[model samples]
Target: MAVLPGAEPFRHEGGEVGVLLCHGFTGSPQSLRPWADRLAAQGLTVSLPLLPGHGTRWEDMNLTGWPDWYAEVDRELRALGERCSRVFVAGLSMGGALALRLAARHGDAVAGVVVVNPANKVHGAAAHALPVIRHLVPSTKGIASDIALPDATELGYDRVPLHAAYSLRVFLRMVDGELPQVTQPLLLLRSPQDHVVPPADAARVLARVSSTDVTEILLEQSYHVATLDHDADRIFTESLAFIGRLAPHAGKEGTATVG
Candidate 1:
């Protein structure tokens, strides 16, 4: 399938500390391009990969599943590990669940994790019917571009593929089961008024994760896609600060300052 023009994957080579960013389901790398660029500017090697079923038409996503998406990010993570001394994973929504899965599977190899509006479980009674709905219908409304900023927009599919969404629920369930195994330091940024991912999703992760160092920051002015909303600066600055505190030696060589 031909990829979208602005949805291409982004890669930047910098120091030994690498940051792998994962965009949400149905969203392309465009969603996290700015964030990846900011991290790269700080002399940190950064990669924002477009998942297997994403960055193309919505119909393409229907042909893919969770494992396919996970495989792409896992490949990037392994590649980053080979060149970078330390590596961290940051994701949005479904990407966050993938990050947790990596932490659970890799342990200390993942230096830390950052998630914004992470979704671990689906809500509403309709979620219970995903299995049937996926077979009956091909798609429904999309959950993209849920930003509080009026003019702000996110590059994602206009329709939600039921088969792919069902796969996401299965993936989330798997990640939830492995949450207790995630012991790496975690930074979670949440928006209280997020319409796409409910606050309960974040609570479920916080309660299950075994991480000793967990920081939860509330983004008052943003929505589900907080990375592109009003509090985007906070997410970027706080993420840099989190990386600095955890990988102090990694940032010493770079001129980037968190302010």
Candidate 2:
């Protein structure tokens, strides 16, 4: 993968376990930065890569597709595998889809997965009907509208590329078929009040995934952006514990080996 001119390299703390943290669609690494910092403090190397066309202008997202996003994630996951004894993945929203896809394709390499408000389906018929609007309307770059993100105090580009959304739907279909292939321990953090992805979808994920070692934690107060909401701390704590358990050094390390 050719390094983008301004993108941050995959971040790694000095440790044996590797983690890749992916942010939501059209969002920056800024969303996951706090969680990444906390994980690094616990001595696990973490990578937070900007997906294709994200962290820049929203118009850029129109040019890129879901495959591009997955390709970038795959590159970072491979890089983490090269450096650490064990690798894990965590993602929010669109990133969650990427994480699951990674686990499906590289199950042997990923030790565990933490998914926060994964977007497996678009909630309603309005979204389904407006599928063609993205093609009709020109993407308004960096348009911040409050309606697009009601729970989130921060707003993102108001306009979405319809074709991009359509592409994302196709990616979801692919991952749905690939779900049973992933067998790693899963920590699903979902929000009941999530305006983006419904609770039913989370249930569907838990049901479909073949992993026997799956735990679902419901977030009552937060919406889709759980990373920055009331349950954010819970996400941090549980995710750390989850990663800590699968860590290569967890029970194997002697007291003197602690870092």
Candidate 3:
């Protein structure tokens, strides 16, 4: 499949500390480019891979599923692990779910995890119909670009592919069941006004994860896409701080300054 402009994956080799960033479902790496760049500028090796079936069209995504997306990120995480002494994974929305799966599966290989409005469970009765509805309909309205910035936009599909969404629900359930296996340091950033993911999702994760070191930061100014919203700077700076605290040697070179 032909990759879209500005939607390509990103890689930066800076130091021995590696960070793998995963973009949300239906959204391309463009959505997290700024965040990746900020991390790279701070002298951390970073890899932001474009999930399969994304950065193209909604019709294409219908042919793909969650397993395909997970495989892509997992491959990148392994590669990063081999190259860096310490590795951290960060993601937004569905990407966050993928990150959690990586941490659960890889264990100590992943030093820490950072997520923004991570989605774990689908709420309401509508979720129950997805298995059948996906076969009847092609897609629904999309849930991308839920940002507070008036002019900011997330590069993503305009519609949500039913088949793919069904796969996402299945993936969520699996991840939720494995949450107790995730024991790495965790930094969760949630937006109070998010319209896409409910707060209960975050609550469920905090309740289920076995991680002893966990921090939750509420974003009062942003929406679902907090990484690209009004509180983007906070997300960036706080993430650097989080990484620094977990792996101080990575931040010892110089202080990260956001312009």
lDDT of candidates 1 onward, in order:
0.92, 0.75, 0.91
List model 1 lDDT by residue over 105-194, tens digit each: 998789999999999987667788999989999998888899999998999999999999999989999999999999999999999999
TM-score of each: 0.96, 0.86, 0.96
Pull out the clashing pairs in model 1. Answer: none
If ranked by lDDT, best first, what sequence of candidates would result?
1, 3, 2
Mark the regions of model 2 whose C-alpha exceeds 4 Å error after superposition. 1-10, 126-131, 139-155, 248-259
Q: Give the TM-score of candidate 3.
A: 0.96
Q: Write candidate 2's Cα lDDT for 85-183 as tens digits.
A: 888899988789899999999979999999998878654564565467666775433322112234644324456665677677778878888888879
Per-residue CA lDDT of model 3 for 26-127, tens digit only, reads: 999998899988998888888999888898889999989988999999999999988999999999999999999999999999999999999998666768
Those runs of model 1 whose alpha carbons end farther than 4 Å from true positions after fitting are 251-259
What's the count of clashing pairs in each model shown? 0, 1, 0
What pairs collide in candidate 2?
Answer: 134-162
Error of 1 at 58 (Å): 0.5
Cα TM-score of candidate 1: 0.96
